[model samples]
Target: MWKNKHITFFITGGIAVYKVVELIRTFQKAGAEIRVAMTKTAMQFVGKSTFQTISKHPVQTDLFDQTTSAAVAHVELADWTDLAIVAPATANIMSKMANGMADDFVSTTLLALSVPVIVVPAMNVHMWNNAATQRNIQTLRNDNIQVMDPDNGPLAEGYSGKGRFPSNDEIFNYIVEQTEDVDNSKLAKLRGKKVLITAGGTREYIDPVRYISNKSSGKMGYALAKVAQENGAVVTLISANVKLPIPAGIDVIQVETVEELAQAVQTQFVSTDVFIMAAAVSDYRPVHFVDHKIKKSADSANLTLELEETTDILKSLKSRRTKQIVVGFAAETNDLLNNAKKKLDSKGADIIVANDVSQSDIGFGSEDNAVTILQHNATNIKVAKANKQIIAKKVLEVIVKRLS
Candidate 1:
């Protein structure tokens, strides 16, 4: 999809730096020119000559080297390209970009560039979780920088959780979107589908002043709704109790409790071609809501609010389904795969997005989602921890494939 585009490719220090050579070649073969910039530490893993030879352009690695900047390097490079992409972004580089630190040439160019930037993070599992590293990543996203998630696989450390970089093709897809000036017709899979998505966490009131809810930011669900609308689907978003700003170009049904969500889902189910239950619905609610918040008294050692099971919205509506695809999510702390499989069958979901939350990499309120899409007798797709927009796009692909 990328043709006649100029891409500013930034290479950072990581074991995955070798992959960038292939990434550069792929873009070149697709009819594009590339400018290469490498971090000081990146040179330790791969030779500067490797990228220079493939790009047929001398690499830029210095911030103050007049020999390179004699051409007004950073400004020229930043202004000449459509977008900049940093592959194998190390924890060190992530921190630099997040905090607006321009100590290095690559990061300095990144801060100066205004078009668009995509950061492909690659680092050790431990480093990915370090408090300092996470803060930086969040900062980058908030700054409107798109980050491609590193796939979970065997790391150079011989350990595996979620710290491997995505394949070259995956990175190329993103580059094409940001840099290339072309549109593909494959985005019309949802042309006539009536899609409904529920987002955020529903609240069950314990009292007039208190309630029970989960930490769902509504980002994933909102993104799903947005993508559906972009693909020509008539989308309806059943939003719950969150302060999230819903995207334009879709209908929104606001709900607060399980009763409201269940009612909304049932009302929309018959006409909906794809039902995405993305809301974190409360499993239980107070048997009786107190009009006033409970008071603390020394004489009362304990206070218990009776609980009642909420409606099984998914299972209850299976008979109401009419050529519609149903999807659900299982956010778990332990026994992830097994629990997800059970929910998939019992809830009658076409696909169950199962995610592990105990590790804290993703789940609940995180912007990134690491999920295993279990479908059709356990055919699974293990998606990495990346931006929710990317995850939503992939999820929609599954729905589209199933529908077709």
Candidate 2:
């Protein structure tokens, strides 16, 4: 999406500065011409040579460097840039930029920029929440600079809070939204709508140490959440125990068991305009809960435990739903279309996305997926094998058509 674009990266000193390397590599892989400008403090955390090697361009670090023949280095760079990104934007640098201070190369070049500037703040939790920093951030926002909120997680200070840097995927999606020439109306198709998505596989515990769960890795669900957020929907994600990072700007509820997932969905279902049940919930669970671990018996060769059916969460919400459009997923080994159509009716879902899980390549923990989307009174749309991100856009496109 960044094909042939000239992108300028302004790095400021922070522990999170290390993450900017991956972001730079991603932009470079997307065919962007990247130039990096780093503050003196930023160089303390990451060497200028690292940026030079990755971006394949000379790192800009000084306003008085005689290395280049350009009349004014900062202005020349500012003119060359199509978009400027200030990642790991420290509190100090943010204050400088807010007050129009240009003591360093990063600030000087930013001050001379004509293109839109995106500022991603990274700082200690207390520093981020400080009154002065908040004021400066507000000032930057008021000046039409795009300031993305830092994520909440463990920081370098051995503490956890809302001061961590956002994931590369989150930043990449934001850049795509800003730079892509996609149809504005299509981009905002879900404007003012609420989307609730459930992802990952729910675990049914046999004991404290062991549980039965599917191989769902939550990639599809996360993709849907991202695509929905980019389409202007207020998104809430009910995620199971998956190792994936949460997409920025979405409310996430973590759950382990099917019962917990069901309750979480019920709480959000009323206000949701669109609900996608992408979670791979266990169909049955152990009927008896053993407080202690079961030991091997000397006489018995095998042990038997009763199992009970789990609640059909989607079907249970069928009669209670109002204007909401519900979607369900069917991971079938056979009769994929017929079973998906059956599920479409039985679950009272507006759409049923069916994929053959028997395939070793495309389903269950795979980065790519192919699915047949079945809807009432509409022909099934079969999406070919592709990355989950692409499939997500296709799914949202169909939903937009249905909602229209």
Candidate 3:
């Protein structure tokens, strides 16, 4: 995906500096041309010669080096780069960049660049949490720079916390999403559209303390919300009980049961341009409700509880939907395509995304997924096993085609 892209990598002093090597190599293997720049402090942790050998380009350290007579070194490099990434961006350098200080090569080039910049911070837990550092990070974000949050784990300070650098694969995925060379017209295809998305699994209560729910982690729905918002949709997320963090710039309404979820969707339906029902609504609920915990008795070892069918949320919306596009999801253990087709018709959905929950690796609670999209009057599209984020992007692409 990164073929022929010009990526400039900047390194700073941190124990996580070693991880930048693998990041450069990953970009190199993807056929991207890479250039390296380092701070004088970064040289202490990783050698300049090491980066020079890996990148096959001279590492820029001195701001005034006259080796390239074409133009100023920083400006020349800045113009050459398609994108800039600062790995192990310490608090010091981030502050400089945030405050428009151009005393060094990295900061000077960053200030001069017209391309996107991605900052990956790595520092001690306390330093990362400090108020001043956070302010600088927010300032950079306000300037439209992409600042990736650091992962939580063991740090070089011999303690476990939230300042560890993320894995190379995660970093690579971010790069791919930001720099795939797609046309600008296709990037924000859903701009000015209002998207309503339901996520997670609804809980059908048996009592105040007990309920029934599914294994849905809400990852897929959250992914769709994120991708849709990134595509310039005004997203409203009606979520169930999922522990994931809410995406920025989304209007979120939290609900716990099927009825509550239905109500929230109905309230937002009028203003929605597109609706995605990604939640796993319970099929049945206990016929009776117990206000208090049921006491266990030794005399009755066998217990039987009656269940009644719950309202089908998607079918209920069919009559109410006017010009809005409706999408649904089906999690079936068998007959995936047939079931999805049935759902696509019965629910009156524009598309039904079906997946096999029988698989151990790529369904329910997993980071990856494989799905087949079923739609009327359109060819079925199958997305092979991949990260949910990638699958979400493909799903949006299909939706864009339909919308256009």
Candidate 4:
């Protein structure tokens, strides 16, 4: 997607400035011509020469650089840019962008550009969570700006949080997705709707240090959440032991055990217009919880654990649902259609998505998937193997029709 593209990096003051150097290199490697515009405070962390050396273009530090060849330096660069990326976009810069304050070279250039702009925010957890910062982010989104959600990880302040800079691969993929031609008419199909999605594999703990989990990477669930949000649904994601970055503008509740996931979903299911159970929840858990890790036996080599059934969240919700459309997923090794049909009937779901996880290429941790959507008295919709995002879009199309 970057081929022959004129991409500009709008660098800002943040500890993650050094990380942008690698991101610039990644774009260049993908055949994009890169230039950088940095704030004066940004230069404090990384030298202008470093970006110049890496981007192979003079870093624009001043809006009025007399040495520049163009009549208006910022306007010239803004006109040249096909895409603008604000890496390590500080809360300060985001506030400026949201409010159209162009005090510095980066903000001024960004304001002049008509091209697609992606703001990658990185800052202290508290600052990222501040009501003012969140309002600014929403304002940018409302203005049709793409604000990439920050990753959840250890922060520079010696603690872990959600304001960490996302990995380069994530930013790259997001750029590719955002650049693709999309049906604008479908974007707001779910306006004013509430969507609740479950993701990842639930972990059933046997002891303090040991547990059982599945191969679910939570990609599909996360994809569903992203697509739902793009369609203007207020999304809530119940994530079960997933490491994926949280999608922007969605409420996320992290869970480990089936019980925890059940609680989270049940809490939100009441007000949800659509509920998607994409999580690979554990069917069973150890009946007895061990406070400590079990030790290796000296005499007997065998150890047995008693297991009990977990709550069937979908079936349990069937009786309580009124206007809500419940979707369930059946991951089957054999008899995919038959199993899915059975689940659709027994679980009383509006839609049952079934996939052959037995295949090694798709399902369970794969980025791509193929699924059959089963609905009562309706022909099954077979979605060919495709990226999880595409699959998500297709699934939501069907759901939106039912909603209409």
Candidate 5:
């Protein structure tokens, strides 16, 4: 996807600046023409000459340097750029971009650009979670700029948290996936739509510390959320217990038990235009709550526990739904199509996506999936096995077509 692309790197003042040095090389290897513009504070961490040596072009740093032959430096650079990436984007630069403040070379050129811009933010965890910073991030998203979600890991402050620079592989893959065929018609249908998605496995507590849960890793739901956001949908993700990097530009609501998940879905379901229920909620819960962890008894050979069925979230929301296209997932070990068809009717869902979880490779915790899409009036669509992101795109294509 980077072949012959005019890509510019805008470096800002951050501890993660040094990490971008090797990242630049990776892009160049993929046939991207790279030029770098650095903030003055960024130069304190990495010198301009280093970038010049690596990119084989003079790094643009000064807003008005008479040494260069160009008539207008920032404007010329902006006109030349096909795509701009702000790596190690500091909180300061992000704030400036959000409010259209351009007092320096980097910010000035960014303001003049007509091409796509990608911002990768890295900062102290406290600053990352600050309300003002978050508001600025939302403003950037509202302005149609793509802001990458920062990774979570060890930081320069000797503690681990969010706001760490993403790995080169993560950034490269994201660029390729999000920018490939940048103007897909299927994706355009999702613009300005409100999508609510559920992910991961809901827990059923047997005691204070013991619970029952599934193996769902939430990869498919996260991929759907990412693609939906890229397609301009305002997305809210209701996530259960899953450890994965949060997708950029999506609101996340965390829940633990089936009851919590049901409540969250009820709160967001009314405002959503599309609701995708991909979470694996436990079928049953303990009849009585045990305040303490149950201990194994030597006096008895076995312990018996009572259980009761949990509320079916999709069925409960059927009456409350208005103009919402509901999608549900049926993960089955046997009779996939029959079970999925039954679910489509019983749950009153507009679509049912079924996949066999008996195969260890393509379902649950895996990164890839193949699904059979079933709808009431439309013909069934079978998507071949592929990465979760690819599967997400196919699933969304079907949804968007139904919307049209």
Candidate 6:
């Protein structure tokens, strides 16, 4: 949370500019001092008064304004702000910025910033993937400019794609994280570390035709991986039966069974600094798997199949792990603290997420989870049900702090 910050929203020529008004207001209400600068084409989408009303400052758009000295208004605005964020950054504007073509006031002001600059690109999916635009985006990043990937959703181009501007909350979080001190970030305490995480649900084969599985959505694992990446760790994600989108900037290894997951983790555990087993691995599987789907018979009375133990991936990792940080999760129905403490010692994890399973809204496929983070020392802390993203951040911070 930025208690008081300065955020300059540079509105570029794109139809998505309309959404920026609310973003400006969000910043202002968060105790941030905001200023706006719009491109000439942006005015065609939103009026200047709309921004001026929320920012409480004249929307600066002209390179030459009477209120300012002979200096370029664009350069002056860029030099004056604490942070620069360009929203609805058109492909053309992106190309121009990459090439240092500050022809307009908005682009020019952006080129002069000494503080952190965030570029939120919005354009047609095709243009977004164009070689030229991508080169510009990469060039900007190579020059230390932060580019927030566009959201994948409905676009003004009449279809859905990755060109949609990110939500106000997403952009806000990025800015706050970028500006926060290293000690306060998830990375300050975690940089240069290695992490391995398990995600999704494990499948147990009953026969050739059917399998048993849980409702583990893997949202928590993905969130933890993302936060771990932010904390500057080398992250490898081991997944099972996950239908979720692949996370960007992580090494993802897909698996379908507990055996495969155990193999993956064991193969990669030697140098890992942190291991987070958040998956809902299957406990039992058929002792003798059917080669083919069993057919029904008219005289059939009953059927029985012996079940066997699935590999405990976390425990194996713990045995082989000496200096690495091992963390596990316990999805429980009752005796939450008791079960959690058991796992903390049994799994050899440095920490365990002990959660009550009776709350349908906060576990196994829910966006939120209520957990008591139990440590190896039997010390425990109850974290109320909250968004998975927030929980992941908190967990990452705790690990980093303990390590520090």
lDDT of 4 by residue, 1-404 (tens): 55556789999998999999889889999888999999999999999999999988899998677445455678667756767899989999999999999887888888887767899999999999999999999999999999999999999999999999999999888877887775232334688799999999999988899998899999999999997886679999999989898888999999989999999988899999999999999999999999998999999899899998999999999788899999999999998999899999999899999999988778688877888999999999987676687678778878988886
List the pairs of residues colliding in candidate 1.
none
- What are the models' TM-scores? 0.58, 0.57, 0.58, 0.56, 0.57, 0.58
User: Measured by C-alpha RMSD in angstroms, how accurate is candidate 4?
Assistant: 18.4
Off by over 4 Å in 5: 1-183
Q: Native-vs-model 4 lDDT?
A: 0.88
List model 6 lDDT by residue over 20-75, tens digit each.
98888787788778888988899999998898987888898777764443234554
**TM-score for predicted model 2 compared with the true structure:** 0.57
C-alpha local distance difference test of each model: 0.82, 0.87, 0.87, 0.88, 0.89, 0.80
Once superposed on the true structure, which residue ranges of model 2 sit more than 4 Å away at CA?
1-182, 185-187
**Model 2: per-residue Cα lDDT over 260-331, one tens digit each:** 999999999999989999999999999987877778899998989799999999999988899998989999
lDDT of 2: 0.87
lDDT of 1 by residue, 1-404 (tens): 44545678899988888888888898789887887999888999998999888988778898776434223567556654555788888888888888788887898888877667888999888888888988888888898888877888999988797889998888778666654563332345788789999998989999888998888878778988987887689999999986877688889999999899999998999998899998888999999998887899799989988999999888998778779999998878999999999998899889988888675557677766777899976569976556676578778877888876
List residue ranges in candidate 3 displaced over 4 A.
1-187
TM accuracy, model 3: 0.58
What lDDT does candidate 2 reach at residue 382? 84
User: Candidates ranked by lDDT, best first?
Assistant: 5, 4, 2, 3, 1, 6
For model 3, residues 1-404, the per-residue Cα lDDT tens digits are 45556789989999888999999999999888899999999999989899999999899988987545333678667755767899989999999999999998888888987778899999999999999999999999999888999999988878899889999999889767765664333336699899999999999988799898999999999999987886679999999999999899999999998999989999999888889999999999999988988777899987678899888999999889887889999999998999999999899899999999888777789987788998998889987666687578778777787685
